[model samples]
Target: MIERGEDWVPPLPTGERVAGAKRRSGEGAAPTHPAKRKAGATERARELRLDETKAEYRLWGELRGRHLNDYKFVRQVPLGPFFADFLCREKSLIVEIDGSQHAESLTDESRTTWLNSHGYSVLRFWNHEVLAERRAVLDTILAVLEGQIHSPSPGLRFAPATLSPVGRGGGASHG
Candidate 1:
């Protein structure tokens, strides 16, 4: 062993160095960065859950605790490189509530594509729809879950009155 200068750094393990080289050259699996990214995503999910939008909180009340048709749902779930607003692992479904910021967003499009490729059906509703048209939103979700409405390829964007309620007036009050 030889003494080193104050600014000298130790060499990485041989295997790690090789993996790092491979990653830099784009010739091998990513070198441990994905796990760190996942951890970051998890932390972001937790933060989002803590500061949930009003629409998200309202929808969660209806979806949590196996409340909807007794199917379990988890909110702010981390998935691969993204966090789904709500996910039902058993049903392979994801529900995303979008605000105005999501309008025509390329990032959202790619995120939806990634999610679809992972075998989950995504249902999207605008924040206003979730807040002002709560019944329709819930009905559409239930319809998709029950196979009454086929899962759209990739994902579906829903307008406030796009789908009518299952068996009653469209404006049925949740209260």
Candidate 2:
């Protein structure tokens, strides 16, 4: 993911591109909380629209209300100061899917910093991972969750772990 100003944005996968209608460029200017609208109304709008779009619907089918492995997840979950794509409240976990533009590393870094600071474990998958090999992505997410369940929290932070770019993946050989 890349950070242009403040938001951490992930890359868009090659084949699956978000249409221009959905792209919100120059979004850095929008306040995280727009003072003009009441907070409840904004939240309700987000909630109501969750299932109104294809991407959200597909993701909801995979994750809503324990749809996967009976593992309960709340959609459009509000955590800390932001909304999570999928959250398991019991585990304090967040799952986010990044698009192609996030290929620039900075965006992911900022997102990690925020999530880590909030005592949440975030697992991110590239859009391609979700689109091309969803099973693999799911397996990785499950493994992370299982590990967290067994161990004491390490208070992990996503501070520049060495990564092999996607196509060159050597299985994320970490330091």
Candidate 3:
């Protein structure tokens, strides 16, 4: 064994506890807290909420506290293994804001597929779209929340959310 400082210890994985470390899946190996695996995601999600993007901060202003047609939305929610930007449990919907970094991103596709498979619809908007066309974005979100945009394609990376026939919904993209 190598000598080490008393203060040093191996970093533990999220949800891991010394009490439950030895449990196996045969007879009695289940964790004491079934939600242990989410502990990490939960912490990370909280951090994301605290460090929200400018676009997220703007859109959240409209979605928070039932400001949008009485729909209650939560931010930085953990679902399965991913954290969603915003989620409305009543409608089983998730809304994500992306920067140019997300254009044509396979990761977003896979995450959307996973969320869709788990009975949730996802809506994505570019950061530019959110900041430049606040009304239309909110309208698109409102339309979705009201079941008017059922089966929303949710704006592919290159596409934009639609509020009307005028623009992508009625605005131009900065990105």
TM-score of each: 0.66, 0.55, 0.67
Q: 1-175, model 1: which lDDT tens digit per residue?
A: 6843321222332312322232111233321321123435556677889989999999999999989989889998765556778986665678999988788554555445445544566789989999999998999898887778763543346212112332112243242
In angstroms, how far off is 11's CA in candidate 3? 30
What is the TM-score (0 to 1) of candidate 1? 0.66
Candidate 3 residue 113 Cα shift, in angstroms, is 0.6
* lDDT scores in order: 0.62, 0.49, 0.62
* lDDT of model 3, residue 75: 92
Q: What stretches of model 1 exceed 4 Å from their correct place? A: 1-37, 151-155, 158-175
lDDT by residue (tens digit), candidate 2, 51-85: 44444456667776676766777765543334566
- Name the runs in model 3 displaced over 4 angstroms: 1-37, 152-175
For candidate 1, give the lDDT.
Answer: 0.62
lDDT comparison, 2 vs 3, better candidate: 3
- Which is the better candidate, 1 or 2, if ranked by TM-score? 1
